[model samples]
Each structure stands twice: as structure tokens, then as C-alpha cells.
Target: MGVSVARTTVATKTGEVGGTLTNGLRVTLGIPYAAPPFGAARFREPQPAAPWDGVRDGTRFGPVAPQSAELPGAPAWRPGDEDVLTLNVWAPADAPGPLPVLFFLHGGAYTFGSSAQPDHDGAALARAGLVVVSCNYRVGFEGFGHVPGFPDNRGLLDQIAALEWVREHITAFGGDPAQVTLAGQSAGAGAVVCLMSSRRAAGLFRRAIVHSVPDATFSPDLAAGLARLVAEAAGVAPTAEGLLSASPQALVEASDRVVARYAADPDSGPLHYDTVIYGPVLDGALLTADPLDALAAGAGRGVDLLACHTTEEYRLMHQVGTMPPATTEEDLARFAAHWELPADLVDRYRTLMPGAPVLDVYLALAGDGFFAAHTARLAGAHARAGGRTRLSRFDRRRTRPDGTPVRAWHAADTPFALGTLDAAGVDFLTGGPADADDHALSRRMIRAWAAFATGGDPGWEPLDGATGAPVHVWAVPADRQEGPAPAHALWHDVRAVLRL
Candidate 1:
């Protein structure tokens, strides 16, 4: 009865062990409730795992889902493992019941990242008296291929499986499974939207927080074409038999390269929003309908929602390619030329940001186009759907590569949200702990998230049209507050009425 439960997952269905860490925090590692999703079972709905003979060793993490590029995280390689359909749990080991449950989905554009990264260690969040969970779902074609006979969204299914596991077993670890918050960033955010609309996800969790939902998607034809792209790249014949036999690495590379090529020039490239084919699509199943379409239709009216985006959404993207010599005025003009921006809007931006270089403008434009708008849309849709929505912008920048100060760039808020700032103390997704300024905001966010999970409100002003308070900006008190952004956030109206 005194066995410490450090790791619990769907792998073993339902069981518990506990342990006190050397640092005084309780930890739980790898406990499974679902069967492995490898070999012939791949591309299918998740199945429950078989029970083990004796107490399983959960001191370490389980194998993460299949991903081509391993971001700086979780146990990518593990002994005695293969399939990546596992999840990790961290708690105070013996934290009391009715604790808030926070289920985290790491972001990587649906391509890279695993639950194994140090950036996602939930022990800190758990110490906050909340139950924490991190999961690894299939990525790339293995996770989201619209092939002839394959499931359209393996990644989404993997998420559902993990949440379902939480529903069934989280209580064993002192978590209030009913009061569950499904939170994610980027593609993970997109998955939150999917979960909102999926009937399978109902009752699995109570509230949702979708951070920087990319709103990345494709049309049916485009999705089919992307399948073909994945097939051709994997050296498969677009037939089920062909792809079924393809190597995981080959498929992963094919998908990643295709996405990278298109992401290079999303507006000019094919499958990229205005360009060409890429990202999750509006398949008849899996998603039931496109999130934008569903949101407009009041599809997720019953779900509570909180959404946000970083101030500098494009800076993280700079890692993708080399920015030409720090961006000049001429460079900005060319970018505007390439994207065909409205003349007035370009002029307004030039006037609004006179001190910034052209490259910064372009990057800002990309951020708004890709991340900010989508977040706004999510909040607006939920508002129109008779659901309450709380919105925010993570304003604090990050530490530079050499430990300098960089403005809040893209993906900067993640480290704080996951409580991993120290482990990944870099610009991309790590930094110092909450200072008085950062802590004040993190307190609000953590509470809001917890409140939303328990109920529907995020403890902030509601985002109704009349209030005019579109979002709460996070920062220190004297300088940190919500609302009153640029003209775009003020002028543009995003309603979620049924379109389809």
C-alpha cells in the first residue's frame, strides 16, 4: 500500500505507484493503459493495454511517438519499447483528491516533438497541487495521413486515447478526472479544436486552452494531393499496401520535407493556406468538419475555451531559414510585393512600426497571418456560440542564445506554461521562472486554466462583443495589463455563425 506511483499511463489500464523525489517533489513516470499501436495495429483507433504480471518499473519515461526530428525532449529512445502511444504522469505522488487535472499536448506543427522533452517536465506544475500529464502521439504521415484506407487523423486519435486514459485512471493518482483541462500549443492547439468537435472527446475533459492554434488546414482535394505527396516521397504507390510497408523514417522525411518546402513561402507556396496543400484537413471523419467551419456553426458551444498567442509569433519561424542580413527596408517592400498586401494596410503598418526593419514587418505579418488571427477567431467563435471565451497575449520576450534579452518572440510562453523555463532556458522555449512580473501573469493564467477546467469561466473578463475587451495581455502590473492592441485587433470583427 506504500508503493510510490511515479509513472502511470494507458499501457497498464489502471494502477498506481508513488515516490518522493530527492528535490522533495513527488514524481510518477511511465504507466500505460493502452496497448501498443505498432505493426498491423497502426493507423487504427487505440486499444486498451494488457495488464502486466508484477509492479512495472515506471522510474523512466516510455517510448515517444514516431517523429523524424527529435526536439530537445522526452525519452525518444527507450529500452524494451517501439510504439509511441504512451503517456507520462507526474503528481505529488500522494496529492489529495479533487486536484485539477492538466493534460498537456506539446507543439511541433504536427511533425516533431515528443512528451519526453525536459521542456515539458510536469513535476513543477504538479507541485502546484494540480495533476499533470504529458503525452506522445504519432506525427507526420503515421499520425495524419489521408491515405486510401488509413485513418485521417492518427494524431488526434492518439490524443483521445490519452485523455480517455486520464478519465479512467487519473483519479488513482489523486486527480479530479472530471475536472480536466485539455491544453496545447500550435498544432497541439489545433488538436484542442478537434477535440472540441469530436464526440469521442466529450466528458473526457471539462475545459480547453488552445495556445496559438495555427488554424493550419487543407481542402479535400489538397489533402488527397498531400497523401500522394507523402506516398511519392515514401516511394510507395499511394495504395494502402504500398504505404503500409513503407519505413517510418522514409514516411516522416517525405512529410517533413514537403511541409518545410511549402512553409518556406506559405503565401506563395502550394498547399499552404493561400498557397498549396499541407496541414490537417476537413476530412469527413476524424475532424467531422474543418474547425473554422465548425466554429462558425457553433459546433463547440458546449465547451469552455481560453486562447492566446505570443506577441512576436514569427521570430520562432526565423529558425526555419536564414533571414537575409537582419532585414533592410528594401526587403520589407519585396515581402509586401510577394504577398500582395492591400496598399493601405502596408502603409498603416509602415507608419505604425517606423522603427522596425522590413524583415520584422514581414515576420510580424506572418505571425498575424498564421497564429494571431486563428487565436482571435477561436475566441470569437466560442463567444458567438453561447460559450464563454477568455483571451490573452503572452507579452514577455525570452532570453537570447547567449543569455541576452529578446522580446517575447514566437513560442516564448511555452516554457512558463509547462513550467520548464529552467530546463530549456533558451529563446525557443525556455527561460527564468516567473519573476514578480511574470509570476503575477502566470498566477492568473494557471488559475484561469484551472477555473476553466473546473467550470467554464477563466476568471477574466468575458470576450463578448459589447465588453470590447478583446484580450488580456500578460506582464507585470505597472506595465502589464489586458486589452487595447493595434487597429487590426480593434477593427476586425470575427463572428462564428454557421457557414456550411
Candidate 2:
């Protein structure tokens, strides 16, 4: 789609911004939500964007946050800049008044991702009669690295800043600030859950859609140990000044080395035999407690929530060769012991899968431990807290070019929900051309998401009790399903035991 030079301008509290009209939608890209977190500002809370003196051009995307060049099945890094605290907007050109806003946060494991990625285009969603916005925040060492004398979770603070910007400026672009729906996938979903528990972001958004939220949180001691390892890799002290002296890429490389070492020997680290080291930290100030505990205490009391996970979320990790294709019973038992899970859990999983392959059993156990378990717990907590909550499972399956079957994996619902199945740069996730059934499923997802953003039911009942209707399943032929309650029950106890 070629963008026509139909100049459109909107006035924000800071100043005016000029955008372009394309395909019946007005898009304003790279609007700064906060000042560049570089130099002395690194590792600190996000500061307000400096006001511009003239109408700023919003025609192209801003540089993404500096991150590692390595990613699974993605192109090489494009050398992003430190001044990357920016956002983009897509609003219907013909909407006369304030429309519901769908604010999105991209995901890359709190490590590598950018809003400028082609897969996150918001034009289709905008054309569906809603205003869509996407923002970029720090990731990896630059965002989550632990250092003395610096605040933790600065990346999350950057997101909070973007939400504040939306509350103060989205109205000028035909979006209702009060009707904002915060949505994300993977690491982004984790951020949304974190924000839901933050007092600073209490009324910033009225609704939330969390897709494939992984169970990862860094305890203070574990985070401190990881910080030391990163600093050792960089040949510097674990302080803000010591880290600032090194180049951003060097810091990223050092962080990667630390992660690899930890993954190789989970028993040697202060992480209690856990491999993954980066994510939201449990800082007492910004994040008082675990998100589940916060939700149970009514932190997200009034926010309508839609939390979902793919039926096979961990398949992507296995398919990309990052993880082994299969695991032994001994390895599974070790993992269960690491998480303090019961010894009989592996037997129970085998019973659940009856004659399944070792890989299938491993995927089931890993998926539940990492993604499904947390998602189910979050949904149940929200619903029990008197908050309107909906749970879903994405069962859409596809085949790879090599004839390998790829089930609905992590991030499979993004393009479908955004109505961008045909968009560029998503072939790896969606595989071959989408069939008729895929298109139909995409339409249903878009419609349901839009309906939920408008504060209406998404053609399903909210989660009542464990015995109520199963989660609204999204598949080639969409339908309501059951039988996940038992798995959820199992995980509920597991998470409680692990205090996750």
C-alpha cells in the first residue's frame, strides 16, 4: 500500500505533529513519549519527552532500542539508537469523534523486539474502526540489567510513560483516552500483567489482552547475581557508571554470555537451578508483589481482562532449535524438582497424554510450566476478584513448507488478531498462504478483539467457576471447548507451591 501525501496534523499537549493519510487511515509514526534514556539518564526512570518547537514530522518510525543482534529465525540487528523511546498511531481517517483505542506493546522476551517490525502493522486494525498505537521500550541489558544506585524495571517505566502519553494526547487523533485497551504478546503480555498491578498505571487503561504470558520473574537476589555476571562479562563493576562506559552492543554481548552460561549450568547460579535470567524484577516500590498476588488483592479490580495462551506455546522454541526436540524422564524429573513440583507430576502428564512421544510429553510439561500455568492462574485470580475475565486457547494449526506440522505456537494469534495474516515478515509464523478457514478465523478474532475493546462481550461468557464453560477456543472452525480445568487445577497448586 502506497502512502499518499495527504498531509494531516494533530495537536498534542507538547506540540503539533504532521502525518500522512494512507488507505483511508491516518498514521503518525515515531512520536516520542519520553526523553532518550542515554548517558546520565541510563538505567533511571523515564523522563518526559522534550517539547518540540515546531510541528514534528511523524512520517517514519524512530530507531528501536539498542539490543542484541542475535534472535531465533529473525534478520540481523539493524543497529538501533539509544534515543528509541517512541510510539506510532493509526486512526481511521473518517472517524468523526473519539474512537476506542487499542494500545499495543510488542514482545521479544524482554530482549529483542521493535514496534517498527512489519508484523506489527496497525493499519488493518485501524481500518476496523478503531485507533491503534504501538510503542518501543528498552530491552535486554539496556532495559533490565540490574545495577546499584539505579531503579529496576526501567523498561516497564518507559511503558508507563507511553500510557501516560496516550492518556494525555490520543484524543487529538480521534481516540477515546478513557476507552484504551492495552494488549500484548509474550514478553509484552507480561508487561501488561505487571502494569495491571502498578499503582502508577491504575486508570491508564480500562481493559487488557494478554497473549502467551510466560512465567518469569526475577527475585531481588537472583537479579543481583545476574547483574554481577553481566558486569563480569563486560569487565566492569555492577554499577551504572561502569556499565555506561561500555558500548551498548558490548553490554548486550556480555548479557548473552551470562545467559548462555546460566542455561548450561542451572545449578551453579543463585537462580535456584533456573536458566532464564531476564524479565520484570520484584522491586518493592514499583511492583509491590507478584502480579497474581496483586490481582488477588484487587489491584486489577475493575479492569476487564482477556488472557490467552496457545495450545502449544513452547513448540516455537523447539521448532527453532533453541531447545532440544525431546527430553528424558530423568531430565523432566530434575526440572520438576527444580521448580519444587511433586515427583508424581511427570507420571500425571504421561497419563494425560497416554502413549505420547517423549517430545510430546516434554512439550506438554514445558508449555504448562512456562506459559499455560501462569495464564490460567491469572485468569482465575482476576475472575475470582470480581473482575470480568475471559480465558481462551488458540488451537489453530498449520504446516511448514518442509511438511512439518506446526501447532498454534507462541505469538500465532498476533497476526490473526491484528488482521495482518497477509502482511510481510510473518511467513515464518503463519507459514504458507492462509487458506479460507484461516481468513475466516482471522476475521472472527479481529471482530472479537474489537468488540472487547468497545466494552462489549466477545460472543462468549466470562469465566465463571472451574466447572463453567471452558475457555473460548479459537481455531479454523471456532467453538467453545472444555477439559482444560483439570490441567488448570494441577497448575494452580504448582504455582502456589513455587510462589510464582
Candidate 3:
């Protein structure tokens, strides 16, 4: 496949940009949404990019935020690359007027990943009659770690700035800013819901599509404690002045060490299992409460909501050797007690999944407790608060010819939803080559996303003030609208049972 410069030039507030014509879309990459968040601006709010006199080349992606992650097909962070707050755009080359926009945020446990991931290609969605956009924000210590006398949740603030840029400049790229649908998965999904509750992000997007929302917010005290640990590992003071003296790489390495220490300690509490130390901090100004609590109190009632989670979200973590296994009764009991789960939770799971081994049961409980149940509860709370909300679950599963079972786990739904199942390196996520039926399912999911972005129903009923009832299940062969699972009742009071 060959690529050439686009004939059209889009003018933004900062400058004009020239992109490339690929397939049937005008694809632009590396448009700065905010200035470099380092040096004099380190740990402060994002600033506007300096205007350029001529058209800036938008042919390549910008640098990823300072982190240690090296995602396949995505640009990795390197020292001396200061420009990380950039965005990408994709619009149909021949589309006539302004189209609805689908703004996406990439997820990596709020620590890593970038919009430049191959699986995040928005060309398919652009061809589906929408302008697609994705951006990179701060992550890891630079984004979420606490510094004395500085703001928290700077990564989320960067997202808000990106949305502001979209609101002001998307029309030049053939997108209607007022018709934006903010979407994300995992940590990105968590950011979506957090923004929903943030008054600062109010009115920026008309709708939201969140998948696999994680319950990983930190109190001020916890965030401060984590920062102290990272600072100690880096041999720097925990204050803003001292932290600013440390290089981003040093902090990244230090954070990794802290995570390793937690993973090795059996009594390190919840961090021992997940090992992800960064997330949105509960600051009373930007984020006043938990997203679940905020949604229940009608924080984002004005925006439409669509939520989803895979049936076996945590299975991928265990299979990939990232999460520690709870194979024994003692391990399960310790996990339950550490996370403060209700005493009856494991017993309940045993009754629900009779004859299953301890590991399988533990995976089910951990997956639901961490992601699936929270996603369902978010939809329910949004609906009950008088917001237009819809819920779905991904249950696509198959066994390969070599007898490798492909359960719908973790990020398996992304390629399908984004129409990127055939993209490079997607086989690992989709469990190998997709068959014809898998392609058909991908088309259906893509169509559903386009429909929902256009403010229409996604070929299913929306949740109408019901708690986890009537969900659209995405699968091959046929999709179905079904009631909640037998275990849904136990998660109704998730805050009480799954306290992190």
C-alpha cells in the first residue's frame, strides 16, 4: 500500500498542517494539542503550543509521554524528545460536510500506550462516515504521581486540553465539534468516566463510549505515599522542586522498582496483584468523588453513555504472566481479605461456578470485581440518574485448529470495535487469525459504534434505569440481548463488597 501527501491543507489555530492520503481517508498525525510538558512547565498545567509561521508536517506521530512502555507499532519514549502532547486525525477524503467525531484515548493501565498503536487506526471508522481523532497525554509518574505544591491528575488535564483543541479546531478537519463522542478502554475508559464527573470537562463531548472501566482511583494520602516511595527509590525529595530535578527516565525506573517490590511482597495489599501504581487522584477540585458515586449522583446526566467489558477481562493478564495466580485456597483467602471483599464472595462464586477449580473461580471473581461489574454499575447508575445509557458484554470465543482456546479477555474487543482485527499484531489479542464469521462480527461492532456516535441506538435496547439488566452481547454467529448474569446481584453494592 502506497501513501501520498493529501491535496488539502487543514488550518488550525496553531498553524496549517499537511497530512497524507491513505486509502480513502486524509490521515494527519502529530498535530500538537499542547506544549511540551517538561522543563519550565514540568508538573504544571498544560500550555498552548507555540504557533508556527508555515504548515507543519503532520506526516509522522509525535513522541509518546515519558514512560518505559514500548508497544508494538507505536512510537516509544526517548530522552530529549519533549513534544509528547500531540493528536492524530482521520477524515473521509471525499466526505462533503462536517461529520460526527469519535475522539479516542488509548489505555495502558494509566501508565503506558499511545494513540499511534497499529490497532488504533481510525481509517476504518473515518470511512464509516465520521472524523476520528486520538491523542497522547502524560502517563506514569509524570502524569499521575503526586508532587507537593503541584496539581494532581495532570494527564486528565491534558485530555481536557485536547478536547478543548478539538472543540476549537475540528471543523477544519471536517468534523462537527458539537457532535463529539469521547471513547476509550481500560485506563482510558477510567479517564472518560472521570471526565464525565469533572465540571472542567463538562459540555466538551455530547456522548461517551467506555470499555472495561477500572476501579483504581487513589485518595490523596495514598497518592502521596506512593510518590514518597518513588522519590525514595530515585534518591530525591518528594517535593516538587526535588522531583523536578530528577530525569523522567530516573522516575520511570524508580516507579518500576516500586511496582516490583509490591509484586514480590505477598502482603503488599491490592498492589501485589495488579501492580499498577498510577491513576486519577481524588482531588476535590477536578475529581471530587469516585466515578461510580458521581454518576449515581447524576454528574454526567446530560451526556449519553455506552459501556462494555469482556467476560474474562483478567484471564489475559494471567495468561500473559502479568498477574499473579491465586491457585490455592490460602491465596484466594488472602486476596479476599487484602482487598476487603465480603466474606461470602468466594463462596458465592463457588456456588455460581460449581465444579470449577480455585484458579478459575479466582480469575472470574478478580475479573468481575476489577472491571466487568464496575462497567455494568456505571451504565446502571448513569441510566438511573436519567442519562441515556446502554450496556454490552463481549463473549466472542473459539478454539483454534491446534486446540488453543480463545476466550474473550481483556482487550479482545478493541480490534473488533475498531474494525482492525486484520491489522498487524492483532492476532495475539484476537487469539489468532480471524475467520469469516469474525470479520462479520467486526463489521457489526463497527456499525454499532458508528450508530451510537451518530446519536442513534446501536441495534439494541438501552438500559432504562435497570441495574445490569438487558445487555447487548457481542459475539460471532449471532449477537443477543440478554439479562444480567446470575452473579450480577452480588455486585449491586460494589463499593461495599470490592473496596480497593
Candidate 4:
């Protein structure tokens, strides 16, 4: 695929926009999916973007949602940049007619991240015979913070609006709207499952791919309580008017303070371990039930689903220093108690991995608790509900030139799935540089994603709901595995005990 820079134009529902041609793909960025979610629209449901008079510039990525963290190769939030609810598109420059569409949502624990991330580049996926779309939705407090007299899950509403835009105008980009596949990672993955259960998002897409869905959601009361913390930290009331009085930057700072406080207090429960302050809120109207319960009840039976999680999902958090170390039995017990795991959970994990360090045991258990288990449960629920589902796990690992080991941690699968292992900042996740085998694994992963988006099958058999067997494990030399992980045998016991 020869790379070139050429102007390309596409007509959208809102207006005509120009994009750049590169690597045999047409890349359009920063097209508004909804009106700027600020000013009169702050903390409310999304509103449609005003139609432009002529061709709009879609050459640059939009500003990210209100966040304090700076990410690699992605735009950061500026105080006055309100046009955050935008979407981007990538399509084969010369598609025969209509191709499958893969709409993506980037993940940063739902508090940070943007579509402009280097690894999120959709050129490779577009070249693989899919029209790729990614969007910048509100994150942090602006997107999830609770306020009286306002709708909850405004970020999800932005996503629904973006999908609606794709359904209405994707044909102009040579995409088959009927074949749209909704895909996301981490918080983005959490949003994917939440949307799957949401009636407001029905018919927006035909398939769903979620990687490492977080085992987290907030009740209305919890959300409101967090909102008050932010409000008090920002020196304002908890009401909508008071919150609106504070700037996005103020709330971002305040949320960081709350996270720091939680991190310092071991008694703060799960938040003390993973201090993300926002997630999908279970409001009675928009989100009435837990996604797991909703899936078990046949909520998304009509959509094809593909789910994957890493073998060592929580390793990245520990490596990045966000998660505190669990070096002692007391530390491990504290973790189990914080997450409401069964009293014997620590002993069970120790039994599963004899001679392992307490930290390793804690990481394994925490990995399952936060990501792997939830992802597996989602597949089981969807399959049991009669949805076509394929389950997979990324188990690739390597030693860097310096002999530092890298496990297949939380997001180690994304660059491979998106065919961007060489993207900037990805080396830290994949370990040093990509070798021949790594590239081959990336190609296979990308193929599975493309195949799944085009058809229902992802080169693997659909999961057998009863046994949940035949999982496709993605590794250097990929292999098919039967039955769940050994530690997973205790998931039922743990979940029953915690009633999660």
C-alpha cells in the first residue's frame, strides 16, 4: 500500500467534508457527530451538529474530552474546545461498492483518551476491506458526572448519536451501514456492553466486539456522591447550576484529587486499588440493569458478539504504577476483602499457583476480577442468550532486549487487533520492538477482526454456550483451547458469593 497525500471528499448528513488519502486509504478526521456538548448543552444529551454551508475541513483530529492526562500522539483538552463530540472515518480509496464498517471507541478508563491516539489509526483496518470509524466522545466528569435535572451517561448518548450519523451517511463513504460493527477496548468496551443493553442504542449496529471490559459500573447514588466530592473540591454546590459554574478543568482537577485520596486510603475499597471515578451510570431510565444481568436476559441476542481479554489483564496497571503492590498475605487479603471476594479466594489463588509471589497471585486474581472474568462472563451470557459469540484471549509474551518480561497485559491485544503494532507508544505495551512472529500474530488478529466484521464467523467456531469451550487463544503460535482457565472454575463460586 503506497502512502500518498491527496484530497478526498465525501458528503455527510451534516455537510460535505474533505479528507486526506494515505496508504491506499481515505482518512477523514474531526467530523462533528453532534453539536458541541457545552454552553447551553453542557451535561445534557447530545444535540445534532449544525449543517455547514460548504465543504468542512476534516483534516485534523478534534480536541479530546475534558481530561488532565496527556496521551501519546493524541490531542489534549483545551478549556474552550467544546466541539469534542466528533467522529473520524477511514475507507479504502477505491472500494468496489459498499464494505463492512467497524466503528471504534478508544478507552482510558472512561476518564481520559481520544480517537486521535496513534494506535487508533484506522488506515490499516480500512485497507483490510472495512470502512473504519472512530469518535471523540466526552469522558471524565463532563461525560459521566451526575447533576440534578440532567441526563446520565451523556458519553453513551454521544456514542449513539455518532452511530446514528454512521447509519445515515456511511454509504457516502462506501460503507454498508447494515454491516456496522461496534468495537471498543477497556472503558470503551464497558460502554459497548452498556450500549448492547440499552434500548436507546437499539438498531444502531449489527455486531459488537469488546476487549477487556472493565468490571465496573456506578449506581445513581454512587455517581451523585462522587459528583458532590468533585463539587466540594471545586468549591461549588452539587446541583447542576453549581457544577456548570465550574470549568471542565476545575472538575478534572477535583476528580484527580479524589482519586489521589482514594489511592492513599486502603480502606476506600475497590476505588483505592483502581481509582477511576467515572463509568456508565445505572440510571433508572437509560440503564435499568447490570449489563451482565441484561445480557443473561437476552438483551443483545440479535447482535453478533466477539469478546477477548488478556491472560494477564491487570499486569499493565501494576507495571504503570497505578496499582499498589500486594507484597504480603495481608495485602492480598485486603484486596480480596475490598472486592468482596470469598474469604477463601486468596487461599484458592495460592493453590492455583504454588510457589508464586504474593504479588503474582494478587495480580492473577485481580486480573480475573477486573477484566478476564467479566469478558468471559459476557461471552457466556451472550451465547446463552442465543447470540452468536466467539471468545478469545491474548496470551502473547516476550522478553525485551534488556531482558524485561512483558506479559499479555490489559491492552496488549489492541495494536495487534488493529494492525498497528509499530505505532508510537505501543512498544511499551508490546515490549521493545515487533519481531517477525509478532507481526504475523498481528496479521492473524487483524484478519479475525476483519472477517468477523464482514461475516459472523471470526475463523473460529461459535462458543458452545453450555460448556463455553473452544476458546481461540491469540499468541505467537496461536492455539485453540478447550474449557476455561483453571482459575476460572472458581468464578462461579466467587460471583455467587459476591452476587456481582
Candidate 4 global lDDT: 0.89
Better of 1 and 2 by TM-score: 2
- What would you estimate as the lDDT of candidate 3? 0.90
Error of 3 at 115 (Å): 0.5
Number of backbone collisions per candidate: 39, 0, 0, 0
lDDT of 4 by residue, 393-446 (tens): 999988776887879999999999998888989988888788999999988988
Q: What TM-score does model 1 achieve against the real structure? A: 0.85
| Selected candidate, larger lDDT, 1 vs 2 | 2
CA error at residue 162 for candidate 4, angstroms: 0.3
Q: What TM-score, computed on C-alpha atoms, does each candidate reach? A: 0.85, 0.93, 0.98, 0.97
Q: Give the lDDT of residue 330 in candidate 2.
A: 70
Worst lDDT run of 10 residues, candidate 4, spans 491-500
Q: Which regions of candidate 3 deviate over 4 angstroms?
A: 1-7, 496-500
Per residue, candidate 1 scores C-alpha lDDT tens digits across 274-302 of 22233566777767777866876787777
- Against the reference, the lDDT scores of all candidates come to 0.67, 0.81, 0.90, 0.89
- Candidate closer to the true structure by TM-score (higher is better), 2 or 3: 3
RMSD of 2: 2.6
Model 2, residue 243: what's the lDDT?
A: 77
**Best candidate, lDDT:** 3
